[model samples]
Target: MVDHMIILLRSISAFVILLIITRFLGKQTLSNMNFHEFVTAVILGAIAANFAFNEKMQVIHLLISLAVFTFTSYLLSIIIVKNRKFRMWTEGTPTILIEGGKILEDNLKKNHLTLDTLNQMLRQKDIFDYSEIEYALLEINGKISVMKKKEYHNVTLKDLKKGSKDLGNFPIELIMDGQLLEGNLKVNNIPPEWVMDKLTARGKQLDDVFYAVKGSNGQLYIDFYNDKITHPIDIE
Candidate 1:
């Protein structure tokens, strides 16, 4: 029982410490981590795991290791941002896989990517035909960036000679998850009474709403907590 309690306490402490370190590293450490950042994360996680479960490992030693790794990663991030040559060497340059609607077989071979995998990646970006792509780059993070041919690109308002005013505005959330967003309503010049009246008209109360947004098109979109549809279409 004593051993179990010690393990539990250690696990909780390690979890909290790791959480603080991750938050200090910022959102990019999790969301947009490059190659080195990913490796650092894996190593930190392994150290934290050992601290949590390894009876032989000292908590103070693990903490020191975590601190050292985090500091090194933080220092590298600063260097990467300030030094161009180091950044290029660390992250590497993007490889051009396709240019002028022609696939570069040599680049694909060098990257160890198969034609089937390339096609799969292209399909994910909604491009089925390789001929439609003007340029496709294999990014350093292993994601593909595609540029469609001029003829295949979607027509924009500018292309049709439409002015900025013609483009519609986005919706702003006034309430989310049963909580009133007074700041959003104030930004859009909407009164609380007006929102209340709209909800009442729809046989709903503010507490019954899961989400409520006001679109620039003068539409109040309200989603109820108990909304139901008998025959829902499957998007996937």
Candidate 2:
């Protein structure tokens, strides 16, 4: 009687605590969770389960443990967001699986992904033929992003006309969350002055910008923090 009531109360307390903790740690969906998130979720669940069911265990002890883990994880997430190198180390960078229709055997081995798994993922995207892929990347979330060859792509209205504009390579991110990616600028040989000039021309400062990317058409696309959208759809 008393034991059963205690168990019910413990279960409710655990559930509420879990909900609060998960809300604070919200970032990725279950389908797109990284390794760090996956591990954190598993451990949190185990701790929560013990808290809910283990009548012999001290509630305060379990709570202290949860608090330590949650705080550490939250701190790590903040560090990952601010420090790019740490982020790469913890979450890992995307690997190029296929480039120019050629599968990179070394990359496949590095990721420890078998050819069969690769084929299955590719087929999920309706990409059956390896030769059709111009570029395929294995994202940190274990999903594959593929870019098909021009010939394999669907015929667009642009293709119907002669002397169509040349679509430049993949889009390159310049400023993410108002932080300038110096490495990207250096690697792509994009002049720092160019970014400043673009921002200046629009009468905006770097801090005002939310995100900026170089489009595939070799043009700069910039978005500001203050979108100034009046009567924006309030969905949610």
Candidate 1 Cα RMSD after full superposition onto the native fold (Å):
14.7
C-alpha lDDT score of every prediction, in listed order: 0.84, 0.87
lDDT of 1 by residue, 1-236 (tens): 99999999989998999899998887779777887799889999999999989989887899899999999998999888766568879988778899878999999999999999999999999999988887899999889998776667678777679633321343568877676778778887888898899888988888898888886455789888887877879653
Q: State how far residue 130 of model 1 sits from its true place (Å).
A: 0.5
True-structure Cα RMSD, model 2:
3.0
Angstrom error of the Cα, residue 94, model 2: value is 1.9
Q: Give the clashing residue pairs of candidate 2, or none.
A: none
